[model samples]
Target: MRALVLRHDHASQPGLVGDRLIERGYDLTTLTVVPEERFHSPDVTFAFPSAAEWDLVVSLGAPWSVYDEETIGTWIAGELALLREARDLGVPVLGICFGAQALATAFGGSVEPAPFPELGWTDVQSDIPDLVSSGPWFQWHYDRCVLPPGAVEIARNVAGLQAFVAGRSLGVQFHPEITAPVLRAWLDLDGGTLCARLGIDPDELVSRTLAERPQALARTAELVDAFLDRIALPVG
Candidate 1:
C-alpha cells in the first residue's frame, strides 16, 4: 500500500511510525509543506496529491497552532481543504498533535488553546488498552481539539482529549513518533525554554525519553499496528 506522510515541522520527523509502516510493506512518501528556511512562517504553495495517489495519509505535528489563522491562514486553509478532500475520497488518515487539530477542524470540530498545556510524558486513558495505553506518553501541545460530532474518543487525560476516531481518521494529541534526537531538536527550538518556565529540566526530560526509548519504540509499533489493522482497514 502507498502511504503519504505530511510533515508539518522541521523538528518533527516520523521515527518509529515510519519504520513500522515500512515493515508492514507500505511504500511511504513524505510530503513536507513548509520549507526548512521558513519553518515558523509556513507558505501555503504546497498542495496535496489527489486521493488516488495514496491509500493512507499520516499528518505529523507542528510548532504552530491550528487556530492561528491570523498568521498561518493560507497554509491552514489549504490543509483544511486537503484533509476534507481526503475524507470525502475515503482515504484513511492519522493525525498527530497539530495535525489532529486540523483533522478535528475538517470534520466539524474546533481547536483552541487548552487551559493546561501538556509538555512532557503523561498518563492517558484509552478505550482499547492493548492498542492504546496510558502512562508516560510524550506530549507537547498548547491547543486541544474538540471531538467532532459522532467521533469516538480513543484516549484521554485530565488535560483534555488525547485521541479519537472520526470516520476513517484517527486524531492523537500526543507525539508517538518522537525519538531522542527529534526531541532534542524540539528542545533546541524554544521547547527547553518552555520546560524551564514549567520548572522542568530540559536535560532530564531528554534523558528520561532516551532511557525509555525501547519501551516507547515498542508502543509506537503497537499504535501503528492498531491503526492499520483496526482503523485503516475498516475504512480502506
Candidate 2:
C-alpha cells in the first residue's frame, strides 16, 4: 500500500507513524508543505488526488491555525477541498491536531480557539484506550475541532474531544506521532512561546516528555499499526 503524508511544519515529524507505515509495507510519499526554502511563504498549489491514485492520506500537525486562511490564503481552501475529495472517494484519512481542525472545517464542522489552550502531557478518555491511550500524549494547540457531521466521538479528555472517526477517516487531537527529534526541534523553537503562554517552562516540559517518550511512542506505534490494519482490510 501507499500513503501520502502532508506535513505543515518542519518540527512536527511523522515519528512512529512513519515507522509503522513502513513496517506494514506502505510506501510513503511525503509532502513537506512548509519547507525550509519556502518557510516564509508556503504556497499550496497542487491538484489534489481523486483517491484513484492513493490508498490513504495522513495530514500532520501545523504550527498555524486552520481557520487563519487570510494569512495562509487559498491554500487553506485547497486543503479543505482535498479533504472533501478524500471523503467522497471513501479513501481513509488520518488527521492529527491542526490537520484534524482542517478536516473538521472541510467537513461542515468548525474550529475556534479553545477557552484554554492544551499544551504538554495530557490525559484522554477513549472507548478504545488501548487503541488510543491516555496521557502523556504530547499536545500543543490553541484551537480545537467540533465534531463533523456523521463522525463518531472516539476519545475525550478535560481539554475536549481527543479523537473522532468519520467513515474511513480518523482525526486525533494529541500528537501520537511525536518522536524525540521532533519534540526537541519543537521545544527549541516555537515551544518557548507556547510555554510562556501556558505559564510553563520549556526546559521542564522537554525533560518530562523525554522521560515519557519511550512508553508513549511504543503505544503510539501500536495504535498506528491497528489503524492501518483496520483500513487496509478488504471490504466484503
lDDT of 1 by residue, 1-236 (tens): 99989898677788878888999998999988877787766655766677667888889999888888666657787778778888888888899999999999988999988988789888899988777777568999999999999899889888889999888889999989888899999988879888988898889988989988899988988888988888877532
Off by over 4 Å in 1: 234-236
Query: Model 2 off-target regions past 4 Å?
Result: 37-50, 231-235
lDDT of 2 by residue, 127-212 (tens): 87767776568888888899999888889877787888777788898888876678778877777767787799877777877888
Best model number under TM-score: 1
The TM-score of candidate 2 is 0.91
User: TM-score for every candidate vs. truth?
Assistant: 0.95, 0.91
Scored by CA lDDT, what does every candidate get? 0.86, 0.79
